[model samples]
Target: MNKELLEKGFIPDEICKVLPEGFQDIEEIASSLHKILANNQITNAVNEITQEKDLSKLTNSELERAMLLYSYVGHAYMWGKEEVEDTIPENIAVTWYEISEKLDRPPILSYASYALNNWALLDESKPLSLDNIRILQNFLSGVDEDWFIMIHVAIEYEAKNVLGSLKKYYLDEDFENKNLEDALTSIKKINEIMNRMPEKCDPYIYYNRVRPYIFGWKNNPATPKGVIYKGVEKYKDEPQLFRGETGAQSSIVPALDALLGITHSNDPLREYLDEMRIYMPSEHRGLLAGLDKFLEEGPKNKVVEHETFVNEIIGEVHKFRNKHLEYAKDYIFDQALKKQSNSNIVGTGGTPFMKYLDKHLKETVPKDD
Candidate 1:
């Protein structure tokens, strides 16, 4: 693929210049492409393994291993296609089915299900539907479902990376809050999946996948308009106004107004906007921009501000403790016939996996963009 991409002159010099610090060599890109191809080949090998209508040709153990291998291959191929913004050929799905037939296990069949159902939406260019969400929900509820994580990653990457322009397009057209909420929910589920992954996994892949969803979540109108700048001198041109009904000063309101202006494409040439509002010197713009920027950079710059870090940690801790207490008082004891310990829990209801999130908050301050 690298050779093809290089030959076709698709590798822009500027894009190559910013080739993500670790991916310095062209050969590494080639190797990654080969890995994707090799995975596809393994999926094809299932036909040979199952030939002559002979279930006796392969032992149960061999069939199980082959199915497991196919699952891994499908995941790798899916990730590769996403990274390059390319599509897998339709022939790949045939191979997926072939491999799935030989396998005795449910996991391989699950992958085959993903390949079939997902390809219809992804490769066949069908719109995302409530049915697709139901399928995803069921898959997540299934056992040994690594493909759920991969599928979650793919959806998130598409929503966050490519959907930003689409989101702005929707914003420009003034879509209703329900449409925006549905979009945000998709990304939110992606975040939940990413957060639930085991710590040993490479977080960069998860981060890259979920990064775009952040912007999608924020741009939605259903989000709360939190307090940003407080008691700071207001912009002379944008003075605080008193509401007729409440009689409270509209400091935060103005900040939100500015944000809507900046994000919703309300007169970009007016010089009042550049991604975020700035007249309010308080940490609102800084805080919001900080989170967005960090995620946008993926894992290249992992550090975060001290106050933000602390706040995030505190928030997660409170969330976990509350959920744990709720589950303990209401459900876990009945389901398992035993009390649960903190160590046995995971995610928002479990002990901290990323303690650095809170620690970084206390130790560092955010530098300006």
Candidate 2:
């Protein structure tokens, strides 16, 4: 397992090859990514996943699949098994319970479901209901110490934020004061619980698991931007928004396959078991132990290798990003900077400044030495 390769060091090249039209500064953009990875604490999280898995059993062809899977596992629970469908909260809680029961672990299913039910109060599709709001508030206030607290705390925090937004949006509309008070109180209680947990104990498992979807908190442009109000009497109702493209699964599958490429030996079962452990929760340590028995037989056919798969996929995506980056550099960034000149950016355009910065970066930082 080459660390630099796994870290997407070759993405820029892939981008350059795929989208040649507007990718002049692709190396520069790639350099910026390297800088971000070096600076951000998230690098530790990425490294942890990489170090834990021994990807020896995967074949060269399977490498892309493994890498894609690694990416997918990060958001497996958030996205549905299929595309464009939201993972229903009730369904997830039920799935967790079933998984837990199979392993003889006590259930923490109801807690997550409860949180989701509360979050639904803020769902823009339907009007906010007072009963749902009160129920959510009461549910949060009651939670103190439970096995589900780890997930519950995060969910409750999210619920509070949603409920707050609802109040803000519908200030003119009459809602129950009791519901608001209860929600506020619950929010404080959740904060207290979160404060007591260890630094490693992140309650936001939902967010972590659904990292890709949650990261880009933007509305899909393909859908209508929702209803707009004009003047005092005119309210234009927009067409209902439906998300057609959620690319999480496709993106993650290739990455996971890349890692799976490394497992080619006579006995790959051990390697497969080792790879799966990274995605397992801390409470399911025994599950990993049980999986050890299954890895006795190694992979039958050596399908792929990690390096080649990663490079290929990186190459493909690099093309896509380079196309966008070229558009940004040649058109959008400069236009944006110029029109908003009174704003932060200062220069003839964005590229020249970024180009200077890129040269400085290449000189100052040795290339992954």
Candidate 3:
């Protein structure tokens, strides 16, 4: 163990204590963190630390707990959502963006993004949901790269179940009439999941530890101003800047758009969807491109059925979006009660994008239909 790193607070002490000796390497630390998470030792630690309201005043143990939660949640979201032969990818030691650029893949692509993006095109059954957005907005105290990563985890987890239900319904010819009902049922299940997420972390703590990493292009008084692509050298002088609803993490929205047959105008959202693919794994991005080609060149009758099914799915998606908007409002209001600014809540700005796509889908019908 690196005693200097632990003493300097570069690495959380709690994690250092739990880590196996000679795991002095940072990558080894990251790997061991996931092992503890997989075994469920970190669950209690996460719960205990999140209970603290003042992150600024957090003891060393509490800080360790938070770091472990952030690291493990991200690790699980990245590797654990699906059944992989190995929990950590062989390339786990590489810097995230470097792995993506060198391998031409999304650095942190998870099961949720993969499943939602490909489920419509691939004839595979997997379990998915969208309620994690609500939990993220309402429960999490801060937003950062790790926070963004976990949002995908939540999305993938919920989306897995939702996709599982949809796959089963579509595979069963007898359940033809119940398709819409099943989609609605999936949305309701997502709502139930959102209702059950434990509201732990103190917002103040989140602001102190996590918020600094999520700044927009506007300069701010923070150590890590916006996300820095460490291994990418082209931007050595200037790091990339991202605000709400931008970046690879937001891929779920466009994936859903593709699945639901919602086309976007040449607007910012459209540009965002196009640009965000750079952040996806190469194979995942290829699958998305394949889905587009499939939609364009597939058989007419099959396309019609897909469009009809997607229209129904979009209707449910609209309802889900509205539900999230409602939650955002309530969550922001709750923050107001604590005298905390509501500006930091996640998913607050998603309503406009959702509304735009929903309207677009409602106005357009399959020409074959």
Q: Could you tell me every candidate's TM-score relative to the true structure?
A: 0.22, 0.18, 0.47
Once all C-alphas are superposed, what RMSD does model 2 give against the true structure? 29.0
lDDT of 2 by residue, 147-253 (tens): 22333324333333423422332222444434334434433443444344333322232112222232111133211242111111212222222111111111121
Colliding pairs, model 1: 160-212, 306-361
Clashes of each: 2, 50, 14
- Residue 348's C-alpha lDDT in candidate 3? 20
Candidate with maximal lDDT: 3
How would you encode candidate 3's per-residue C-alpha lDDT over 46-97 as one tens digit per residue? Answer: 3222221233444444333333333333334322332322122222212334
Error of 3 at 270 (Å): 3.1
Model 1 scores a TM of: 0.22
In candidate 3, position 40 carries an lDDT of 48
- Looking at model 1, residue 223 earns an lDDT score of 22
